[model samples]
Target: MLYCKDCQLLCEQECPQCGSRSLRKPQANDPVLLGVFEPAIAFGVESILKDNHIPYEKFGNLGAAVTLYVGTAMETYRFFVPYGEYRKSVSLVEELTGPAEPSQEHE
Candidate 1:
């Protein structure tokens, strides 16, 4: 199962066909979207990707417009990215916003 702590949403435990939780995020190689901790961050990163012509999409509950607004306003979201693209996306984001500290890696 995949649990997005940032968005506080639980999705199907595994892929419908493969039953694997290793879903991949798109544009994992972008250099400006390490971790989307909040809806605002996701929106900002999405804009960056769009500007660069990098095809990407936000996953998890925060992707929903209503959920994003509620989560951001309430400050209770637990967002998460697809498992596969996490590393590459993080690296890209770090390159754009400076290297991430060890403690902030999971943030």
Candidate 2:
């Protein structure tokens, strides 16, 4: 598999999205966004990644501070994985939390 470093896309032949031939094998340190999930689901995602032997990084959003005073219901966490393992990690996470929906941006 080849990865378009600029577009952060995984492809077999070439990056169809960016039409860039400057692709290379994915590396263990390349970070990719897996998804942003609720606290409950984030814990599950961490466990699944560990079981699958995938390295991951987790970060809390601004709402996380509120959780310290309020509760976890309002908190969200972002998950990232090595770009090399992103595809597999995504599949595993989807099984636990269903597929992620695309976000809409207002401009």
Candidate 3:
């Protein structure tokens, strides 16, 4: 069995989706994609950045309105930060959601 490391799909011979016979595996130096998020999460991330002084840019994949309205859009979103600030930004976001309240049983 063959696999497409790029798209992480199991294939018979070649990647029918990406049409690549020799897909390269990702390396440590490769940039990390945080996530594709819904609007709420997108806005929340933006707010978190603003509050923590972390800079980011939105890479939206918003497709046709007709498709969105019909709930058939494949649109996704990505946010990026510079390589230098990536660690700091990730740390801040983690801290924000980290251990807000103790468990109710403990409380």
Residue 75 accuracy (lDDT) in model 3: 45
TM-score of 1: 0.38
| Candidate 2: clashing pairs of residues | none
Compose the digit string of candidate 3's lDDT tens values, residues 5-50: 6644334667765788884443433343444455666677778878
TM-score per model over all chains: 0.38, 0.65, 0.47
What local lDDT does model 1 show for residue 107?
19
lDDT of 2 by residue, 9-104 (tens): 556777766788888988877876677777788899999999999988887775556778888787778777888788799899889978767541
Candidate 3, position 17, lDDT = 59
Two-way TM-score contest, 1 vs 3, winner:
3
Q: Which stretches of candidate 3 lie over 4 Å from their true place?
A: 1-32, 64-75, 96-107
Relative to the true structure, candidate 3 has a C-alpha RMSD (angstroms) of 10.5
What is the clash count for each candidate, in the order shown? Answer: 11, 0, 0
- lDDT of all predictions, in order shown? 0.46, 0.76, 0.55
- Rank candidates, TM-score, best first: 2, 3, 1
Cα deviation of 12 in candidate 1 (Å)? 25
